[model samples]
Target: MNETLKNNTAAAEVDTRETVLEVKDLVVQYVLKEATVEAVNDISFSLKEGEAIGLVGETGAGKTTTALAILNLVPDPPGVIQQGSISVCGNDMLNLDVKELQKIRGKDIAMIFQDPMTSLNPVLVVGEQIAESVRLHEDVTASQAFDRAIEMLELVGIPGARAHDYPHQFSGGMKQRVVIAIALACNPKILIADEPTTALDVTIQAQVLSMMNDLKEKFNTALVMITHDLGVVAKMCDKVAVMYAGRIIESGTLEDVYNTTLHPYTEGLFNSLPRINNKGSELKPIPGMMPDPTRLPKGCAFAERCKYATERCFEERPASRYVNETHTVACLRYDEPDFHIEGVED
Candidate 1:
């Protein structure tokens, strides 16, 4: 960690706000007839009320799996939560019955999935879709729910008259806003947005992100933003947790991770981004690919690609340790005295 950056730890200190969501030692795996896949290895994090955190990494880094686990929606046949606890607003999600879990899904916690086109029911009017969610959770009549749905559409910047429009009638950005409106229809305490802007154009993406941020503030909702885009993370998140393979390699406040990145994987991610000031420079993408989930490395999953990895990194797994009070990283080099990763010069 950079010595100068260590002094800027005020934002990374222990949050005293009420914890809205908590995951402890979560282990999720997919059981197959041929081979078992370790999707999410013992990863844990928490979100306080109205706080936002970005879960960032390459695809198949178990970001979606973690979100599904939080909602207790991981499919039973193939996917399973092998161990750990997920608590939302003090309710134990893992132990709840089907009926009990349904009560919390749309009411307490909501999710905006990856693709908006497939998320909505094409046959149903957009208003009804939102109203259906409202009716399920709130003790409101059909007419009242429909009225609430219209308000939700208007809230997302869509016209109330467009409530009768089907999903196909709206553009890509409009559909996403509808999806967001539905998720926030009942005022969920937590919102998990999994690459909400992936399918939209850059202009629409910016608008949607701004809208979501404003809505989050208005509702005081804790948010978990899962994406591969560091740019999105910087704009919307207070804290960041970088994932690799199936575990969190590094995590801290935006300032801590961005200014004083600890893990080599995190460094690689930053290096891969195109710099505005140095437009002519070539991007430095991480070498090698993610390890096979079915047969993950015995030690560090990132050792093969990390420039700083030693023989010890390939043999012994490193435990997550806090460099400062709130900044945590899982690299063996942190155990060495006065060690720091030297930045690569262009």
Candidate 2:
């Protein structure tokens, strides 16, 4: 993180309202040679306590970047926290020093990544991994931590109570369970799950999601689930944030995004799905490729592919204007309520 990026963390007093995690005006840049890629543009949103908000986008749309930025885990060389305020559990994550940040990160907030194998240490037994997390954050003895590890593994639906099992002893699903168990061992108030169900079979996915829901309810943890799967988002989230080219295109309640998709980018996503009842129906993929983040097009990045885009969209980016009390979409068509998305179909 550059000094410029580090200094951008000054934040106003938190919104005493229903927000527990507030990611405000965040921008993340990855400098490669002479180029700087805006992995996450000026994006902002809030995650209330016990609320699950899904972040959905195609690969490279900055879903992971946003998550990493919040965690302050952006690696060097290619990444820098450009600007933003990531306030979680009444603390400013970006502004805090590394020592202070570490204390809050796993202790108050946790993350579960996509690849469990890489996440786990090959040398250490799975039990010690979770035990280390508990010991790191809490004043617990090794025996107590080991016992807690077994309890958490059981909570996450791992079959065996053997905390001494090595990472290689577990199945892919089991590895994920262990990863999640380690994440929750510290009893964090916030949990960030990045592509939690990817690389798992459908049955395992459901079970993991069920376990997560149970855990969230039990712990009252605010969850930030990052994924490209609309199905997962629909199934797991109360609110949804749809991103394109590093910026949020639309955001609202699950019903708002599903029932009344205001952005054309979101519409394209919904169109690309096969209806549940229409099994024989053809899958409609979104036409055209995703925009390159490093050299994004002028105005709205999705304008070229958006069916509702107009000539004006080619010139200026649309502000995230309100559609209702809670729903907001970054599209100019909403300026005229009578304008139908079907009008601009290519």
Candidate 3:
């Protein structure tokens, strides 16, 4: 195994006590009619049992594509996992056939997408969705599955345990929880939550986040939370991966990423954090839109907006450089011994 993957598994083992998922050199590409776009460019990471890692990036930064590629859910024709390997428990998932992958997709690996209303089936009852997930993985009768569905609802902090409740009967927060309950109903080893708090109100968002955190500990499931919210990662993830234009710019422990941020894109995320001092001030959003996947820049993706970007940053693509024991960034300038963490004012 490469050193990065080894170290990643080691880092994952720190909190989880066991490695569950390992993704290496994941490259998802989209073959449009006119062009090919690299949605996930050479990304690698791993998750251990009971560990959570947040993948942070803007809307078009290829966060969702990376998540989907992990589950081999990339839509065909337009989208394809062009390269790289993904392994779960030492088994290569990228090489698995459709039928073989299907057996693991929900049974061992589950995902909760951004919009629950769209992701959930409108024709099916909420309980039915959760029960179907259970019955698909386990040998159980319809009645037994329904009872498990109620248990999942209760597990997710939902009030009503009625198995007849439909998606229309629930609010946005409730729908999100139902989606989560369905995701967890199968008792998957790895759960990928993609923008889980997108449409939730502040109070609901916090409650749902708290419930997910509680569920993480209770189920001992490794979590890959893909979100643009820095605060969420700091609160929920033990480690974080900062992505930009299809590649991971930085990866570190929550303390290493938040307390001593190394990459420019990661620092931009700090601008989004809620602050008591900045209550009256305007929210400082990250400047510059993401680069087009079809025409990605030759070097660093954040070069256009990064204040510290040098000619080398744009002229040459930097390799992943390690700073200390637990942090890595794809910036060459930081290879110097005198390199310091940027934007983190003491």
Candidate 4:
């Protein structure tokens, strides 16, 4: 992790621009017959135009739920937005009507789901799917939308002539590229990519990520990338927000969080990453699994797994403490003068 951080030191500088996505006190919950699961608990973060923020955490840390909440796509009946404010390009997402929200989805914010094989319709031609998204969002004829779809396919490195093919006709990597094209066809202001590279091989993952980076720059799109891959975060994001349970435990510029890790969980995350130089060393996985969302602890959710956890960590939840202008961490250790951990900053 240290070597990876050192090598990617130049990846943290995000361009300053007007805020494109602002989420404040966002809380999402799921109600089942058995229990009420708190999926996202009072989390807030903002993204600037043309910026990308990596939401990194273990599975069930609410990364995908956060993305769904932002796009107002949280499944109802079981899932509900208990409270939150999601603003995209100055438009209030939670308060919008169904008609208005529908209008905003493809044009203002688009999503590329994790599995392209399931995301794309198996029966329909890939070009038609992209064209449908374009025609739905923009006032264009079917012919024009098809042309735009072809252009989008070309942009993602898939030949425009291949647009007539079905999902089964393309390879895994190309299918993912088609997903990217559909997300970009509307030229959305924001793109929520949920583990876009999870299904691809290493080489294909690199290609998809490279295309995403190029397309983001071309469209000036703000992105909320939800993934557990730190290497992906280092390469694609300017800032990072480390999530635990349903909350953002630490957030700042990539350098601040990666180089000077503050939270014990954040430190543990970096420690857990396999170092390229240390070939013989065993990887340190975070102890225990994530707490059950339905039965979360009254104190810190990570207290059970954290080695540095004290009595206070089990007794009370910590408030967000600002260690610097750009960095903030939620931990009781920072409040205690006697608490100290090597390789961690206050």
Worst 10 residues of 2 by lDDT: 8-17
lDDT of 4 at 21: 97
- Candidate 2 lDDT at 304 equals 87
Per-residue accuracy of model 1 over 56-158 as CA lDDT, tens digit each: 9998899999999999999988998999999999999999999999999999999999899999999999999999999999899999999999999999999
lDDT of 2 by residue, 12-86 (tens): 233233467889999999999978898999999988788899999989999998998888888866898878899
Which prediction has more favorable lDDT, 3 or 4?
A: 4
Q: What would the per-residue lDDT of candidate 3 be over residues 182-201, giving only the tens digit for each residue?
A: 99998888999999997899
Tens digits of per-residue lDDT, candidate 4, 46-104, equal: 89889999999989999999999988888998999999899988999999888999999
lDDT of each: 0.93, 0.86, 0.84, 0.90
| Model 3 TM-score on a 0 to 1 scale | 0.92
How big is the RMSD of model 4? 6.0
Model 1: per-residue Cα lDDT at residue 270? 84
Q: Candidate 2: which stretches are off by over 4 Å?
A: 1-18, 342-346
Q: Which residue pairs in candidate 1 collide? A: none
- How large is the C-alpha RMSD of every model relative to the true structure? 4.2, 5.5, 2.5, 6.0
Which prediction has the highest lDDT against the true structure?
A: 1
Give stretches of model 3 more than 4 Å off.
2-16, 272-274, 279-286
